[model samples]
Target chain A: MAALVETINLTRYFDIGRGQRVHAVDDVSLTIGEKEIVGLVGESGSGKSTFGKTVVGLHGKTSGSVKFRGETLPQSYRPADFQRLASKMQMIFQDPYSSLNPRMTVGEIIAEGLRLHSTLDSKQVQARVEEWLVRVGLQAGHMSRYSHEFSGGQRQRIGIARALILEPEFVVCDEPISALDVSVQAQVINLLGELKETLGLTLLFIAHDLSMVRYVSDRMAVMYLGSLVEIGKADAVYFDPKHPYTEVLVGSNPEPDPELERRRPSTAIVGEIPSPVNVPQGCRFANRCPKVLEQCRSVTPQLITLKDSERQVACHLYN
Target chain B: MTGVMTSPQTIPALLEVRDLAVEFATYGGTVQAVRGVSFSVEKGKTLAIVGESGCGKSVTVQSLMGLIPMPPGRITAGSARLNGVEVLGCNVINGKDIRGSQIGMIFQDPMTSLNPTMRIGDQIAEPLQEHRGYSHKRAFSEAINLLSLSKIPEAAKRARQYPFEFSGGMLQRAMIAMAIACKPSILIADEPTTALDVTIQAQILDLLQDLQTETGMAIVLITHDLGVVARVADEVAVMYAGKIVEQGSVDDIFYRSAHPYTLGLKLAMPTNDPDKQHKLNPIDGSPPDLFAPPPGCGYCPRCPFSMKICDSRPPENFEVAVQHFSRCWLHHPQARISPAAPSIPRELYVGERA
Candidate 1:
């Protein structure tokens, strides 16, 4: 199957001070198949969000190519091109309350995207808005209400509605349900699952929570300090994570099982994440990795595919 | 049942809260933010208060700490005993003395918790000066030690830097330093890890656990994430509609939860295994409004097994086992307390094979 979206060696760097640059996203390459949900899992400052934004043309890429439907994205993204792409790709932000324009009513918020991309008239837009609102598990009467009037869950539903009303084939769900209550989070996840099937949407679900990502995504990518450390089928990556970072991430998460809780080995990864601006010479996670080799400091590893599996890992251990 | 001894070295409870009820006098009505909530934290152990937003977890702890303001909100009735002293009834002088020295609190956002205008050293020293009346030299040295304890590298140099100079994780460490400056016997952490990413979250949780073991201070961790509660909490308190619906040892609550609300919450959490998608059973409907609380059980409207008796009368908190209790009609003797029926599908309970 042809990829809906692909990034070839995408990189993003920020100049912090004199000659010091923060390589937020460095040489990341991945592809999202049509109607497939790809989860980008990582911790703080892993550059997952930055990478997502770069793909969607929100952030200017420092180097490398982004292709949408086999066409290479322009160096300096044009608004016209961006608008055209916006019709096929949309992003749901981390915080629903802040991402939304607070002043606009829910109706205006959902319809604004449609207005920008679609040729539908006012009546048709209203109908479409109502349709999406209902699709996201909200009432039509809620259209007149402001963002503040709704709960965290309802606000996120509005966010989903706004993103999907454009009828985008791909969506970047950046921690959509993290800020919500537990029950509300389940509702949102379930809703997204249902919507994915109904709309035939491709998703790049960026989240810190490993469990939810594992559940929702078909393929998974583990990132650390702006690089893809591991990528494989969701089940493969979670059950038999090969990368050291993935092992710690999977093990570190609190399991629901009471027996496992008792036997929880002290696999706590100590030490704070090194600053992105002054990232180390070799592997970004080398400083905190428990099984760090001497070669890990001097040589950076390329993401290479393992035998008889789709899994790819960027570590010298694999080599 | 196997004789798994529940007894650990029974240290005196550092903080005890009894029948805590907090209400806000709003134009709409008296908003009962916390209703008859009670729990205790023992020294050297971590007690996690887990619940969704508007579940009264935060409000209950805030009320216990006397952090709630007077005009709108007031503690109608409760006694919060800290270090064998009544904290809620303490005078301004005593409260101030106890706040940083005997009881410390870490809020949700470290960025907001810290003073942007002040140097990190000054912020850490504020509690020491106020509580202990330490000299500048002594306070500064102690502040550096506290920072180091929180695992901030080059504590002496970083002390001179502002809060903005530090990253989110470092800022949180700074917050912890400030919190533990006076060696408080108790620390109330309200969603301290929520703003952080998972890896950073793990680091902070480890730090908290280490600090608890080292200082022998009780920690009251307030959060909505069950994963966290499962990881760190020695005991768990599940709150709903301004009341503690279930309170037990972490094992008791996680494995054999008596409350329908707790069960629902556990079910809702997405498991780490990808094959367990069917296990995620989200509860239907929203939390009830505190301004107009339900006459009976607050969760009765949404509970799948809610009965007629559940609608008219509030169920008394019945003891399920020693030290484990839940306020639900299903657990009541009068109600048809059949052993937890296997109503939920097997796939939802049994996770995918490892």
Candidate 2:
């Protein structure tokens, strides 16, 4: 199957003065197939969000190519090109409260996307907005309410409705349910899953919640210090994670079962994540990895595919 | 065993909360946040209060500590007795003394808990100075010791820096240091790890467990995450609409939950195993408005097993086991309720093992 979206060695670097640069994203290559949900899982400062933003054209790529439907994205900053792509690709931000304009009513928020992407009349827009509101499990009366008046779950529903009303082929859901309550988190996840199937949408679900990402995504990718550390089928990545970083991430999650929790192995990774500005020469996870090799401190490991499997791991052990 | 109660152990708990009710007087109306809630935490154990947002878990704890503001909210009726002393009825001066010295609290957001302009060392030292009357030099050294205790790297240098200089994990460690500064008997941690990433959250939870073991302090952990509750809590209290729907040992709560709400919540959580394509069964309908609370079960509206009595009158908590209790009418004989209409769909209970 042809990929709906593909990034070829995409890199984004921030020049932090004095001939120094921060590589927020370094040589990341990925593909998103039609109607497939790809989860980008990592802790803070892993550059998953930066990668998502770069793909969606929110951030300009320093080097490399982004292709959408066989057409190469413009290298330079072009508003028209971005606007044209914006119609097909949408992004749901992390914080629904901050992402939405407080002054605007829920109706206006949902309609804004339609107005930008569609040439619908006022009545047509209102009907479409209502349709989306119901699709996201909200009532038509809620349209008049402000963002603050609604709960975190409702606000997220509004955000989802706004994003989906455009009927975008692909969406970048950046920690969309992180701020919500646990009970509501499930609702939002289920809603996203259902919507994906019904709308035939491709998703790049970015989040720190490993369990949730594992549950929802078909394929999962782990990021570390602005680079892909591991990528595989969701089951393979979660159950039999090869990379030490991935192992720690999976183990670190406190198991919901008390029995399992008692017997769960200790995570190999310990101590706080190192500063992004002072990234290490070799493995970024070398400082905290339990099985750190001498060569790990001096030589950066390239991501390598093992055997005939789709799983890719970046570590000296794999090398 | 000399001082311990007889078999089936009916000794008074470390903290006993009875008929606890709290209300907030807002311009919109009087919001009854908590209503006739009761539970207890044993010594050297952790009691997790689990609920969704606006379910009044935080409010119940805030009332216990007298942290609720007067104009906006007040504990109307309740007795929160800690070690046989009434905490709610105590004066502010006495409460302040008890707050840091006898009962410590860790709030949800560590960034907001700390002062931006203040040095990390001074913040940790403040509680010690206020409660212990230690001199500035002594307190500073004690602050560094506390930092080291939390296992922060280069504690002395980190203590000299400001809150902004610390990472989320470091700041949380600092918060823990501040919380345990006075060596309180009870530590109320309100979602301490919610804002942190999973790796940092795991580290912090481990630190909290270690601290609990070292100090033998009873912990009242307020959170909505069942996963967290399962990990740290010795006992669990599932709260809804300001009342405890279920309370039991961690094993019972996780494996053999009696309340439908508790069962639903467990089913809703996404399992870590990626191969399991378990469909999440989130409870339908939102939590009730506490300002005009329903007469019966607050969770009845969303509950699949809701009976007619659940919507009419509040169900009395029935003892299922020695300490396990649930407020659902399913176990009560007097309710004489039939199965829900059309019955809860089989798919809703899909991965639920018998």
List each candidate's DockQ score. Answer: 0.57, 0.65
lDDT of 2: 0.85
Q: Give the per-residue Cα lDDT of candidate 2 at B129.
A: 92
lDDT per residue, candidate 1, A1-319, as tens digits?
6799999999999888899999899999999998899999988788999999999989898999898889898865788988878888899999988998989999999999889888889999999999888889899888998999988888999999998888899999999988888888899999998888888999999998888888888999999989999999988898899999999888877666656766777666877667788879988879889889999998998999999989999999999
Using DockQ, give the best candidate's number: 2
The residue-by-residue lDDT of candidate 2 on B259-347, one tens digit each, is 88888887787765544546887777788988799998888888877787889888777777767888877777555445544354443
Candidate 1 local Cα displacement, residue B171, angstroms: 2.8
Error of 2 at A192 (Å): 1.9
TM-score of 1: 0.93
Off by over 4 Å in 2: B1-10, B91-95, B273-276, B334-354
In terms of TM-score, the best-performing candidate is 2
